[model samples]
Target: MTVANGSEPKDNGGVTPPGDVTPSETPDNRPSMSDLAAGYAGKAGLQRNSAGHVDMLKSAGGVQGIAESILPGLVFLVVFTFSRDLGPSLIAALAAAAIFTVVRLVQRRPLTQAVAGVVGVGISAWLANTTGKAEDFYVLGFFTNIAYIAALVVSIAIKWPVAGLLFGFVRNEGLDWRKDPERLRAYKLGTWIVVAVLALRLVVQVPLYFMGEAGLTALATTRLLMGAPLYILGLWVAWLVTKPAAQPSKPSSSAD
Candidate 1:
């Protein structure tokens, strides 16, 4: 047997030489799951910026996203108030959503928010018109809140807060944030905030829904009051909670 560098033999009978070995050639050299997990951390960090508000808006589709979200309901309310006609009110709301979608497409912005807005308005209008009850227009929102509450609770139960996953994913922090106790706690807190917002929506709107026609206007008001503004507030708090912890300074070296 011949040795290289006065160490182990380069080849012994059937054994392959060290120089021919590569990471992919051996099972021990295979990349671990942790390595894959860490690889995305840098990318997540790059996407997340210092301005949490802007990032939140970006996730929703920016200032235009806000407009798209609110305008449909606003238009429906205003038109319904003046016309006192369900068909016309629904039409106006749909038109407003369509306009937002068009504007988003023309401006080359993301269509996810715009499309969602249009669909939500369409469903709400369909429910109200089909059921011959104006209050049904807000029914979709009630179900949506319930769904959100369930989802948030489920995510927390699984030890993965939706707020943390979403914010970390956007910030390029990936699942690495979960490894930090402080960051994980922040994410849990943030997830609860979202749960609270959804719960509040259900609490306020459900009663109004059962009130019949008299509650229609009140339902609309409550929807507006607790809609985007409350969600944004929760998002902001989550961002604050997830902020990176300050690193401890290294101990100063003693002079010899």
Candidate 2:
């Protein structure tokens, strides 16, 4: 169900249930659940290249995006480790994020990721500065991981796994995969794979977080390592495991 650029998707012969309003027929023209799922999959940091292979780096937003995500925290960790000054460390981190935002603005590119980086850096700086504890900078990350784990668990419990919504759409299976028990089970497993990754972060970092100022460097380093890189690895593994089995090819007819 791959859709090419500037082309309409071919119908997969799906039928809308009776009394169900299509997107066009909706009063406010709000997108359907399927539409929302598709949009999420597109941004889930998983993409198939022209060769039909998953291009993890491209999906992770290329080299520039990866640097934008890591450098601010890296800057903070390095500066604070040497100077032991929260003020300068926070400024350096904020500057790193702000530089990315400025580059995006100057390049006339979409500001979504860059602006998000700036906002996240700003919050971490504020939390650490206000509490006068360098460790507080990572407090928000703990809550974020817990929230995602909870969401994924809930989705699996409801039998509409997050991985199904994400990977199913990316694979062009749409919501139809939910009707297949085998695929449904595979997606549930995939969702748990994601849950494990998020859980691993909390398990490893929370203890270091509790160590207070003394554990700042280890906590920061672990956070950077387990952040995007771990996520990509987990997602890749889940995707590979959940892939649909290939159908057996039919034999050709003999000449009459």
lDDT of each: 0.70, 0.81
Cα RMSD of all models vs. native, in order, equals 12.2, 4.9
User: Local error of candidate 2 at 205, Å?
Assistant: 0.4
Question: Against the true structure, whose lDDT is highest?
Answer: 2
Q: Per-residue CA lDDT of candidate 2, range 39-147, in tens? A: 5566565566665556678767788889999999999999999999999999999999999999998999778889999998899999999999999988989998999
Question: What TM-score does prediction 1 earn?
Answer: 0.76
List, residue by residue over 144-173, the lDDT tens digit for candidate 1: 888879988998888788776566644446
Worst 10 residues of 1 by lDDT: 9-18
Alpha-carbon error at 3 in model 1, in Å?
49
